[model samples]
Target: MIVAACVKLVDLRPGVDRLTGAVTPSTTLGCSAADRAAVELALQLADSWSAESVVVCCGPDRADPVLREFAAAGVDRLVRIDATGAPDSADVAGLLATTLAGLGADVVVCGDHSLDRGSGSVPAFVAGALGAAQALGLVEVGTEGPGTLRATRRLDGGRRERLVVDAPSVVSVEGSVAELRRASLAATLRAGDVPVEVVAAPGLVVPPTVTTRPWVPPTRVQPPPQGTAALERVVELTGAMVERTPPRTVELPPDRAAALIVEQLRAWGYLEAVPSEPATDG
Candidate 1:
């Protein structure tokens, strides 16, 4: 089986200054130790299924840097899509589907969520585009036959579900399921000369509903301290649980705040009062 791993290269430490919300570019934006561990586990899983070739794909902007990193991490070919596009979920999904269509790939795998866009749409969308079955949050991938694949998916609340599907399937792997592997010095040298195929964006059309913006919010000063301990105690007691606290105190308007408080209370089963009956229209 030929397995392809889709990897997203993103700035590791994103966000303007926590204080000023300024934008800065740094090399630390690549994959982390945990991500490397996950990739390693994924490679091992693919090997277990007798995958003859494993290709890692990334966007043009991230190609060189990611290729170097993956090369050092023991990955042979880093498939770099040289087209300059928005890298939107749907657009990238289409690009990947087109690339995988002729590769005779039996199974495709991608990270459950990318750091840049945690939309969780790419894998499934790619599967749909390729007319393949897809499994999300997969922890383990196994094989059933020459053209069949089995995936073990991680579910919420600490459970797992196993699904077996025919060839040409997509599997999105959870970061916690497998550790991405780190490349050795020898592997890096060998991977440097590995042939890379540059593919165009295929003029795909992505939906216009999504917008990319740098998240910048003006810094706000903390509220003035009141000397009265009793007042602080009252406010604390009246406040909801700490875990449910929302950041950006001013972001929630009055109506939204009321709705959220009531919703949280209902979710926690703390609301004991019953509403009055509505009057019939005359």
Candidate 2:
């Protein structure tokens, strides 16, 4: 069995300059937290199945370090798709799908979303391009049979659902469940010597899809007061304004409070309504 782990190199300490709204570079690059989880999961699965693990990435030359780190960590192969500038998510997905297909990967693992963009769309796009079953936000993965992949997916409201997918499937791992392992000194030294196979992107035109929108400050309007209103304004300025009443609080029984919480949840569409039983004539 062969497994491919798709990952992205992201800013290690990502943040925005509050005053400028511009991304503040931490001057470091590494695999994203989500991708690290995906890679860890892939490594674990490969070890369990005695399969080959491949680390794949699509980015510029700056991403070489990340790929090398993964190679040192334990991947059998390291492939890098060198891109010039930041490409669209669709283009990146296309490149990854193409590369994975050429590699003949039985299973593809990736992070549910990229830390930089947080769009959470690339994995699905790759699955669609490959015509493979997709399991998103998976916290656990294993094999049920020779050609079947079983996964536990994290859902909303802290719920989980187990799913079984056939071979040639794409699994997007959740970051919360993936903990990366440190590479040994020997492995690190070996990784430094491993040559990363570089591939050029296909003849797909990547148009500029992202643009910065100008920020506009809000404006407030105040109508001119005259006659009675003007007199009231003058009185207010003279410290004779009426005092406002404080809000009142109410306490309810434990059961009632729980019911109210449930009602609020339902009203806000956070809870689904239970279906009613079918009516029958007796």
- What tens-digit string does per-residue lDDT give for candidate 2 at 1-282? 888999987777856655556664565777667899889888887887788999888877777877888888888899989885568888889999999999998899998888777777889999999999999888887787654788899989999999998879888987876787899999998888888899899786667635444475766685553437877877665646658555555589999988887987886777997577999999
Off by over 4 Å in 1: 14-22, 32-38, 145-147, 156-159, 202-282
- Model 2 scores a C-alpha lDDT of 0.83
lDDT of 2 at 202: 72
Each candidate's lDDT (Cα)? 0.66, 0.83
- Give stretches of model 2 more than 4 Å off: 13-27, 209-282
Candidate that would win on lDDT: 2
